[model samples]
Target: MSSVPIADHALLSDCRTAALVTLDGSVDWLCLPRFDAPSQFARLLDDEAGHWSIRPVERARASRRYLDDTMVLETSFRLSGAVVTLTDALATGGEDLGHGIGANSPHLLVRRLECSGGEAEVEIVFEPRPEYGLVRPVLSAVDGGIEVLGGADRMVLTSPVPMRVEEGTASVRLRLVPGRVLLFALHHSAAGRPPARVWPQGELAHRLERTAAAWRSWSELHQAYEGPWQDAVRQSGRVLQALTFQPSGAIVAAPTTSLPEGVGGERNWDYRFTWVRDASLTMDALWIAACPDEAAEFFSFLATAAGPPGEDLRLQIMFGVDGERDLTERVLPHLSGWRASSPVRVGNGAWDQHQIDVYGELLTAAHRLADYLTEIDEGTRGFLVACADAAAFHWREPDQGIWEVRGEPRHFLHSKVMCWAALDRAIDLADLLRARGRVPEWTRERDEIHREVLERGWNPEVGAFTQHYGSADLDAAALTMPITGFLPADDPRMLSTIDAVERRLTDGHGLVYRYLAPDGLPGREGAFLTCTFWLAHALALAGRTGRARAVFERALAQLNDVGLLAEEIIPSTGEHLGNFPQAFSHIGLVNAAWAISQAELPAGG
Candidate 1:
């Protein structure tokens, strides 16, 4: 099993794909061409899976940071009497493009090493494993670097220094003096396609400069948040943008997959796909922290991906980056899971689950972006209306909740509330567009659903809203009630529910469990980072500013050194246990930080 802590890795992206570089200078996890593509380096999952590393020959201390408001990562390593800095990024459109990085731009991974002080000896290892380590490619020396040939894929690596290929791996050792720099570029393409041209050492400097500038330019336009927790908020926004598939404007849930939620357990899952709920929340977070253009593009992608509304009105829960619907889950038994968390999964099985709450999320996103939208084509508007109608029809149905529990479907209170929100936002949108006549039925259904939730979803005996209708289980997801505007934050019922959640769901360290109920999964997972952020947001909305700030800070404390968060955190040990750099968790941070900042602002100031 791979022993590298998830937090030790930093992310690099060109807005189309992502690569995770560890502090020790190893590219352990990367999917080429697209976020969900088969990885070339799977060392994060197993030691022998595959990896490419450029690290000092001797033990060295290292520290890393992003290059000022960008996804470009800089890691500085210091040896006994030497120091070097490694800059890593996936290449993007340069200054001459007259714009920021485009998703369809070339696929190139660039690494530049510069000796900042004294001199150091570094070793470079390049091992390419295609199709998740099942295919060992053939390596050959060509021109300035090496060419990797494997099933249906070709990767060419160009290096500034000489390298030797041995047993399908490339190895090199180089001495770097002060002010000296070495450049390496890897270009990927399909086997039958023309080989990608390798970048020369002279042109690499310009490419690196352009990539950094492109990221900075994009950050300048998208990041508008100037509130408290400014640094964390902005970093989270950048991480979200990095995870976005620029071509489709679809943001994935997370880049890595099958990172266990619980060590040595079976709860591991693949999170690289774009879930409707997650993508919708991403839109909401982007609107607040970044801009509305991303939200609009994502909605358009969803409309095209979801196709025309069917009679049933149910949408697929998630889709591939290219909008393909066949996300059938499968296991790779050859690879031992992370920390022995077995049965490493690839595709997600949740695609077919009937998640009724997605309607609410999609409609709410549409409503939020309505004002900023350039033009809502009649077809898209009609599609949004149908989604609201579907929620009205399905509110009475039992279905899988947001957690996507593998257990039997139940009438989860959160799902019911979101169903109500669907109608609410749909009604609001109709009025905004002066199409109120089209959604009169939505208004009536919205009221009825709201009343039904109050009557059946709340458990007065427990002094809190139950996890499901007629059950007394407390759920962190219920904390979204106020955040979604389904109820006033300070309402007596809402307040009681908050208190009950703190009393029951919290791990006593400000971390929150999704719920304690049996989830049909074999192992217990950690506290969900996003849910913890929700608790903070809910508190701020309730006017408990002091307590809200405390909870918010506690949640912020869980972020890794580089200000990135995973899907879950071990409350006792603070170990990041799920997919790293989770979009949902970061969205939670941005939204929660926004709420806290707004609440702290002097009234009308």
Candidate 2:
């Protein structure tokens, strides 16, 4: 944690991979070839890991923003009398590639420098430490540029200003006037792949332009949300798109791994894979922010990726972008985590945990995209039908809850409610999925869950529906009871749950915590940002739009300068914590905004 606040970084993507750039123009976190691949730069986790940075020789006031609707980042650094702008993008194949916009990306990162004010001086630092800072590449000057050789990746750094590099480190300084412009394009090639030709300076600039254009075009055609928090909703839509793996239609929870939930504690976990639960919610959020095409495609990807829905009705809680199973969690004790949060993890052990809530989420996403999925094949149809069956069978059994607690599994009310949601949606989609015969079975189980939740899941002692059956502790997830329509928003029980959560689970601020219960992890964690949005959404649905607006505005204040949010917020400091650019946080933002907008609509307007 270069002590760099997680919120201070901006995201750049070609929809294939992502890079996190700090305010001062440093690519602190980036994974090439693919989002979950070995990092080419891991400075976000440790100081000695590889990083490429360019900044003014003197201190400068920095301001950054995405280029309008696109994911391309533009940062301006102002000093004394000079101002220099840095434009960065991961190049994509331009024009109408539909969902395949980045299918033909050249795996090139383009950073363009331009001077628009008085003369300025800047320095460029090139360091390539591949395989998670384990192998330091030998830098050699080539005809086109510098060739980095070592590890599993060969990187070519092309620049107009020449610099002699002996080891893995290289530095060059350049002076720029009002009319001056410099370009650096770093291209990557892994073993067993034919390496593309080194891009010339002129072509590198051209590809950068095309990448921006492609992103803008993608936004224009897809992002049609014209409601409250329009700017944030649109920006989040781009961020979610940026996190998606183009070829697989899988949405990663975040790009970086091992950013701590509790700084200087052992609470860090990797979030670079496609979580079935998260991806399902992401589909619903994206449906509102963008368009239905992605939602449809994601369902298709899910159907194909999770295997033939298994005779045992089992599916992974999460899967690799390419649908690979067996995600074994391991740690790299070498890299001292951000802020000394040691034991940087690579893979997630939660992937193997029995997260039974996924069935409900998956079927819920399918229900939302039912119209777009009219042409789903029989295999896909059968898979979804099997998912509903799984929910009916597993709703009674308990595994890890939605928070993926490492402790013993209990009867999580949220899991049971989501199971009810699955069966309800399955009944509604019976005709479409050709499973009308199973509706009776699904209905019986659905009603049983509803009855049991109202009886056992609720706590009259606590005046709320507790975290799990018969528990006195409250959970912010209880706020979802109304949002999921399991109970009407204004129902007495749902309102009491909301009031109890606000009264107990908040950080004395508007921000909400997942819970205060021990998660079988050492040390305490920060307030989850997503839970705050859930509070806001619940308030809006419960006819308290005024207070809902206030909560929404308060949560919006936690967004970074560039409108990106992290996974959690430190209650005391109001500082961002956990993984940066978390998809769940943004998804909550988009959905809460939508809920407010809908609630605000005039009666019969």
Candidate 3:
């Protein structure tokens, strides 16, 4: 396990929830019911804690990929004379498979094992550690298989193979013949609750087929988009959907926990929660694919999450899937961090920081989905109006900036532009609403914000935009100028800014730094994946399609074998850093691919 890179992991989800599965047949990270919910199995952050793993007993070669369009993952292990495959997914609700669970339902992990050739020995290990390695859960026999418990938290494991229940864990050794199969189901909940009814093997099989069909059915709706990087674009769309929490349509930042930013440094922060920034971008990604249902749901989540008008909106950079706001940061002192990066943090402390750009991001998303916002409840509208009003007044304040830097707030150039964008979008919304008799004051504030940004944010001497008011540092964030329609991609300033970024921010291989200056904390960081994607989009928009495609291909080369990407990539070695499967990176990939597919590529093999 230590030999495998973190990028080897793939993701599986039930739309309402998700988990991280490694290539070697281990579910290293999972939080039971919701993305922000505490983990029942957190071996990714601490190996000795509880995790459910099944792999061939003998040394073998293993490979994996998603099953068609669905979130279902297939990992095959080949021994010298035998082959075995394992399929994993969370039981989803509704449709044919009946694998879906409600928003408030307890968490579950369903894994199926099949022997494809000859007979091979397989091992099943269930080590349940509680409280992030603080408690050693006791494994006891249960009706179907076994149960591991610590205080109120309960982990139930069900398997067809004979098992050993020992100190704090369960194990099984089985000879998997060609016709033999095993089903392992893990249930997490309070101790006194009735054990969840295990899905019969036949029903589980039916659900798996139905789930695949459902994903394909949903994917068929994307035929409207015929851009150049069609396959990659569509894959990005599918990934966004897979990462989304379907009940509310809110997209999480990433599906994994403690996949360190600095590789065991204190930079590790929980990314399972929904970010206002991420969910907003998700709306744009879904909209580009013509998926209105998802767009509408995310818009609604924003409205409810932003709260009523006039009161300070709890504009967390991130939130729980159910919209819970308090994500208290804590460290697991017992477990060695990923690659020995100490202080594995579970919750995000940035939740309480004031990120002024959130309102702008929220408004931009809502405005993009304005055509669908009308279909949402009236409260969402009120929240939108109220949020607009708050942003109108607060747009001038300094914030933590888009990077969510832990350092003191400065007037980050991007954050300020987004503040203006928030107002601009709100004004656009106001006009759209006014034709039908809605809020008119929003239009006035939007105009005022636009004027203020042009005057205060631009730097004349640099021939390019700077990182903040009066700061000379260049930022890759300047790339958003054209993408947001704030300026034409070919506009003098925009072109000069792109050139400036190319000169200062872009390293030789086309990887982009978030900014040239240090971001308040110690140590260096990887080039941001989203920035490179933005560069692709900007180049495409500026009629540099060939350059755009070249850049796009270079960026796509960074994707892991499973086509998953992290928040940042180490420029030299390409080791993934920051959050794994970052939503912004995926969103950027989708948008850039859409742009690049329209650009012609050079003659290829």
Candidate 4:
């Protein structure tokens, strides 16, 4: 286990939830039904705690990949004289399925295995740890399978394989021949309800086929990119699709839990929750990729989450997939974090922080939605008006900025830019409304924010905009100045700012650090991957394609052997830190790829 790096894990999901399938053939981290709900198998973060894994009986070389533009994963293993394929998916609106299983249905996990050639022995393991592995569920043999009960959650396993049950888990071993297929599914139902297994084996195959077709059709809808890095862009789009929480359109930052930024360094935090900052950017990425409905879905989620008008909308930096707000931070001391990183924590405390950037994300997202809507709905427009009004009233005050550093509040420059974005987007909304005979109040607020940012945030003495007002330090986040259209990428001020950031904060690996300061936390972290892509985009937009491609290549090399990248990469050891396979990191990759691809085009076209 120690030899296998966390980056070796591949993601599988059906939009509502996700699972981490390790290269060694284990489904370690899965939160069934919803992204934030209790894990059905949580062992990825804890070695001995919660897990439901299945693999071959013997150790073997393994590889995994998505089934062509779809969220389904096919992990193949090669052992002596035999090979097997494991296909896994969240059992929801599959083949012939339009959307997903209705939210009301019990959570289901469908594992299908087929032997293509030779013969092989297989093994299956099931371990259910309730409440983050604090409770030991009582397991019993049922009519056709096994039942696990703990607290309010119940799990029923339906399979033809025989297994022994003991302690808090179960395991089974079987021999397989070519053309043999096995289906192992776990159905989660209300307490006392015998697990429901509605789909027969034949129906399961049809569901798989339909699900594959659905994803392929969706991918076809993407207009031809014809860009140089189209592969990277397409991969990023698929990742974004996997990260989206379909029922509400909320996009999670990452799918895994407790893949630490710094091993045993107390930098571990759960990232399986929706973030306005990430979601806003994801929407932008989707729009660029021609995913109109996905972009609109993000705006709808923002509208729903931000609440009606100003009601002091909860300063939620994160929320559950189902829109639950009570993400109280807690630590599980029993099981060590990834690679013995101690004190694994669940639920992000940042949710309680008074980060002001969310308002900007909300407004900017709404602005994009309104601009694209053929006919804007009154409810959504009214919600946007209320949010813009509230933002106009509180644009100047300082609190936690985008990084959510748990330190004293200050005027974070990125936060201010986002505030400016809010007003700017609102003004765009106002212009659209004026043409349509709607309200005209958004113009004043929009101009006010623009003027405020230009006046209060720029520091001429530094020859570049500072990280915040009253500070002279260069911030890597300032790279967004060009991307947001706040300033031309080639403007001397923005160029100087970029040069200053490269001089001060570049980790010497082509990746950018969030800042040079400690950020009120112990131990140093790696260069942020997302910021690196931002720098790449800024470079290309500024007519530095060679430099941009160089930096982009350096960043791309940081992806693990399996083509999966973590949130950050250590400048010294090149070790990946932070959450594994982060959506933010992928989103940045797509943006950088597209920018690099476009930069190669002739200027006239």
**RMSD in Å for model 2:** 1.2
What is the Cα-based TM-score of model 4?
0.91
Q: Highest lDDT among the candidates is held by which one?
A: 2
Q: Model 4 over residues 35-77: C-alpha lDDT tens digits?
A: 7777777777776657777788878788888787776778888
- Which candidate gets the maximum TM-score versus the true structure? 2
Give one digit per residue, the lDDT tens place, for model 3 in 192-216.
6666554566766766665666666
Model 3, position 67, has a per-residue lDDT of: 79
lDDT tens readout by residue for model 2, 26-103:
998889899999998999998888899999998999999888778889999999989999999999975534456787
Alpha-carbon error at 34 in model 2, in Å?
0.5
RMSD of each: 1.4, 1.2, 3.4, 2.9
Which regions in candidate 3 have their CA more than 4 angstroms from the true location? 1-3, 94-106, 191-194, 197-199, 221-224, 311-316, 431-448, 598-605
Candidate 4 weakest lDDT stretch, 10 residues: 96-105
- Local error of candidate 3 at 455, Å? 4.0
- Ten-residue stretch with the least lDDT total in model 1: 95-104
Model 1 regions more than 4 Å off: 95-100, 191-194, 431-434
lDDT of 3 at 330: 84
Clashing pairs in 1: none
Lowest lDDT block of 10, candidate 3: 96-105
